[model samples]
Target: MYAAVTLFVFMCLTATSHADHHHHPCHSPNMTGFMSVMTLKGEVRAHGAFTYDSMGKKLRFRSNESHPVNTSIGLDVLMFFEEGVFYEIDSKNQSCEKKALQCSIHPMDIPDDAKFHCAMNLGNPSIEGEGFKANVWTGDIPGKKGVYSMSVTMGCLPVSTIYFMDSTTILFSILDIENEIKDPDLLVVPSFCQGQPLEETPEGTVNTFYNEFI
Candidate 1:
């Protein structure tokens, strides 16, 4: 009976660990609209306990590789402008051809309720998964170039955004109060995206390819 009980407990623990591993949300383009690219410089302070992921050969976020100093470190983040489009990447990473891979524009499919303006206010956000949630807030992030504030609730997680600058340059700052530091190394640039001159595809559209470096 003792041995049986021990086996049962071990099984339960394994099950729980497996369940926790599957919490990452799906990241794909769902919303559509014009795309814009820019670089952001700032300091990252882990307000709470956070862990960075360094696995995944592609799309890896390797925050654990180097222990990020608690002090202010110069940061360059790649920003993609499109409703519901968010990706964090090292903006200083360059391509072999000497092109700045700091950021890229990924076009999205527009939603029926999509609106183009300076502000959005969405209440009662929903959660998509572990470390993933859907949120809405209003701001002049794409146009007008003004400071706007927004709050989003994804799966009960509250996220806030502040639009600090918009003009010849656009800037949006995001703070995840309850952000779980899952591997920040998950989003490393693929080698194919590293360096290449402009080229046309068979579809007559221009796109860049990145190699798997993670």
Candidate 2:
């Protein structure tokens, strides 16, 4: 009886440990990231937390030596079905007149009902070691450059985006990617955001925005 009880207790502890390992809301992308950042101008530093997944992206950027001492935040909920083709939820990440007007680098207004934007092969993609990398051009916004990277390691798949800038480098990394995004509400814009149901695919709307420039 004593030996049996001890075995049962050990089994319970092992089960609990396994459950704890997979309990996070999102999966870590791969390897330890946001590790260190290096700039060409001899400035290197670490920043804040960043999270990404099928639902969206959230990042808090800390100012470095080259930048002003301010904490700026950027959150973008995104989805992708094809290569270089994805929908960036717009209500929270809005541009003027549904991207009708030119966007400024200095920040602009967020329309209550902004449609999703399509990001096509803005540029070509390349690979870095076991990861993937690409630099694309987005012409609707003021700046027309962006970067995307991805890697899968030890059952953790992390996808990241680094917006290209002549001045600064910002990275959006998604970690611990498990659990299918079964919640439709997450993909939907809240009523307060004033977004209407999309008529066609979100990718179609983004295509229209780019058609004007193309």
The number of the candidate with the highest TM-score is 2
Q: Write down the lDDT of every candidate, Cα atoms only.
A: 0.27, 0.28
Instruction: Identify the runs in model 2 with alpha carbons over 4 angstroms from their true place.
Output: 1-149, 154-156, 159-164, 194-214
Q: Compared to the true structure, candidate 2 yields what TM-score?
A: 0.29
Q: Which stretch of 10 consecutive residues in model 1 shows the poorest summed lDDT? A: 205-214
Model 2 per-residue lDDT at 29: 27
- Residues 1-214, model 2: lDDT tens digits: 2232223323332332322332222233212223223232323333333222322321111222333322222222222222222233334445212122222111011111222122122123354354433211121233354321222223334333233344554433333334343343544434543443333434324332112212
Candidate 1 lDDT over residue span 98-156, tens digit each: 22222131111112222222222222335433233332323232323343333234332
Model 2 residue 148 lDDT score:
19
Q: How far is each candidate from the true structure, as Cα RMSD in Å?
A: 19.0, 18.9
RMSD of 1: 19.0
